[model samples]
Target: MTKQQQDEPPILPEEAVADDSASIGGSSTSESQASLRSSILDYRRENGRTYHRMSDGKYAFPNDAREQERLDTVNYVWMLTLDGDFCLCPKNDISAKRVLDIGTGTGVWALDYADAHPETSVQGVDLSPIQSTYVPPNCYFEVDDLEKEWTWSTPFDFIFCRDMNGSFADWEGVIAQAYKNLEPGGYLEIQDSIWPPVCDDGTLKEDSALYKWSHLLIEACDIIGRPINQTNKRPAMMEAAGFEEIKTTRVRFPISPWPKDQKLKEVGTANQVQLVHGLEALTLGLFTRVLDWTKEEAMVMCLEVRKDLKNLKIHAYWNGYVVYGRKPLSSEDK
Candidate 1:
């Protein structure tokens, strides 16, 4: 989940380059590439739609009832980062001093953080005040926007942001805000995925339907002046925002359980199961109105996308880049 300009998160230190070179290895990806992908982002789908209910986007979570299972499922895979050091440290190691969770949808991560680390204070904020009212003593959920000037008035040692992709209009500003709000030597960790670029053996044809269909998101973000392309810009932007010691890693799940890597296959299949339930709101609400695709078409093609997820040998993967860096201690900066 992420702020605006999410979905296609910016580049990690790897997977792509800031040069916007349009070429990788000996083969250039731009010239004669036949693919219409943007230089800003590689092939990916955007996720994180929890804020739609409050705003004018597609679907709304917690309208009448909360899809607690769906929200928690999306959060479980990345629980690795839910520690003090990793940023989700509630009910985890208490080494972390403080944390701020941006776009905290269900307040699940924040509550978990607070529970795990009773000594640490954690705050979760969203455009919608739809999260559970019950929370850990160390955790609190509020209604706030990461982009509209942070009002917390307190600096934190770690900033946790998820699933605000559709709600952010200025991602760089958000990152800069994280930099500003972080205590020196604090950490920032993020996880998100909703863009789609399937690679069956890396041979999914350029003309493949997914290429065109997934672009609906690209177009929609463009119209809104936010972007699905924000994923690829993290490392550089973080560096520019004045973070250091940056490291980036990628995790990919096949759309289904067809990968040779049984773990990824399992992950992909599990993720796909979740997607089956969330796909309509993700595409129809997130992209349809802007892209003008009908509910029937989205329903049909997304099902195909689900089928592709489990196609064992497709080598198809959607990647999430995990990166963390310390806010430079002012003395260290000198």
Candidate 2:
């Protein structure tokens, strides 16, 4: 309690003392584990953008601030497309007690769902821990790979996935896993966009930059073993996974503000905004890493695509698919 003794340096813990000693000689077991964790947290920098290091080459998209803002914009675009609805699953179908959000990028949808359904306990899983720290008491996040074996012991009542078209190599496997992890009669909802958008009015020419961009993106994803054009094949996949009462809904997501309808125009405008910010983030990694293109070449291609996006003459639109299905009530039904 003396002043002299109080001012003296406090004795270090045994572990801390050992750590210091190890630092002077070599890396200890604790230090090695800490280093490995640090590497997982450390984002990888490529072509002036930062990407997730946990699943290094799995998802070819940036996880930095700019990309996060673009993702939020995409969320707004989907909201507008869905007429302000967060999901298409019927309220009566959801148990509202247990919910799982797969590939929750920023945890926005999970947080919103948890806030709206106070009784729901929501768990969002992603490869990166870039989600907001401040979350609803009923909602939390975990950093894990869904492609790996799921270790959750409890079954989820409702499992949801969105905007994950090109993020997986085996869609059927993921669907099977969801079916296995869901409670009997539980629901699984997936929302994704059809890639290589179609044009009905013949305005999207084959030589157009936007058209070329879409096809090239598809090719890149295919080469990387994660095809993005699997929206139409989801229903059959769900059915194969022993799901019943499957429902499929498609909405028009225009590329520009060229639609005559008021709501369509609004959705188009939001889509344009998202494309403006997302063009580079979406293409840079795939082009540079998968397609073996130079960074400048990729930027030029993005510039051309952006120009085409603003032309307003092309009537191109991606088909937004919202597919949901319910698990069978019993083993006999399954």
Candidate 3:
């Protein structure tokens, strides 16, 4: 990272704050709410999908309503897959005084955590301002790019991030920033799905459109210096960042409803819905902008990929990894 990159400022202004009346259930709208909506409308549009114009092309996916719905569905499915568990870290049972959630899409996890632990102060930051206007008293939302320098005033006891694929060009920089911002013995948890599904039964053919889509998207991301398949390498990166007692857990997430087990079937069913709903939002920008595909051509390819996502006989699943580590209690221990 260059010196300028290391010193990059937050995405939002220092005085920017979420509107308290903008919560999902609230109907009141303030000046801040109108400002937030106008800011979101300023995003660049391509093929009916919106991209973050302020991010300087660091992130590829849209931040529009359709994309936000897909993100919420993903969070819902993850909660169901984990049997309602929020954090898988061993220290989850401990009451954290301060928590920071990076890339907090819609602020769902942060709100839930704050509601569950009223004593904790939770701060959620993201590149988009789509979070609810009404949030808990103990929970707050900010618009900031996590790839830049963190200007938080205090260290956090726990830091959590999810589904941050294709958002950061330097994974090690993010890990190192987390290490620097965490209090001693503080824990960091990251959850993400490995891009490009794997099939063990040979049902997902090499010529399948889903396989082609993955290859094209991965290639596009690689050309942009951000690889989406970094979930498996997170443990090593965390270890290199001076974190201790690192742990990683992997879960198989089916692309369709092909699993015989009830839980797996449910997960696959939910995933099928998520993939189908998000196919365009996930690929339209990348394919059209980076891969030189026309909008119609991209839509046709996405349709083919959606068909494969709903095919029950495919028996394909992506690896979802949850990795966590703790900062040492003392400098000597590190």
Question: Which candidate should be chosen as best, given TM-score against the real structure?
Answer: 2
Weakest lDDT window of 10 consecutive positions for candidate 1: 16-25
TM-score head-to-head 2 vs 3, winner = 2
Considering lDDT, which of the candidate structures 1 and 2 is the better prediction for this target?
Answer: 2
Compared with the true structure, the alpha-carbon lDDT of candidate 3 equals 0.80
When sorted by TM-score, best at the front, the candidate numbers are 2, 3, 1
RMSD of 1: 14.9
Which tens-of-lDDT digit does each residue in 258-322 have in candidate 2?
Answer: 77677888888999998988899999999999889999999999999999888777777887789
Off by over 4 Å in 3: 1-41, 332-334
lDDT of model 1 at position 299: 75
lDDT of each: 0.58, 0.82, 0.80
lDDT string, candidate 1, 84-188, tens digits: 234432213444677778877677878776776778888776655556766666776654445666655668888877655555777778888888888787888
* RMSD of each predicted structure: 14.9, 18.2, 10.9
Off by over 4 Å in 1: 1-68, 80-94, 206-209, 331-334
The TM-scores of all predictions, comma-separated, are 0.73, 0.88, 0.87
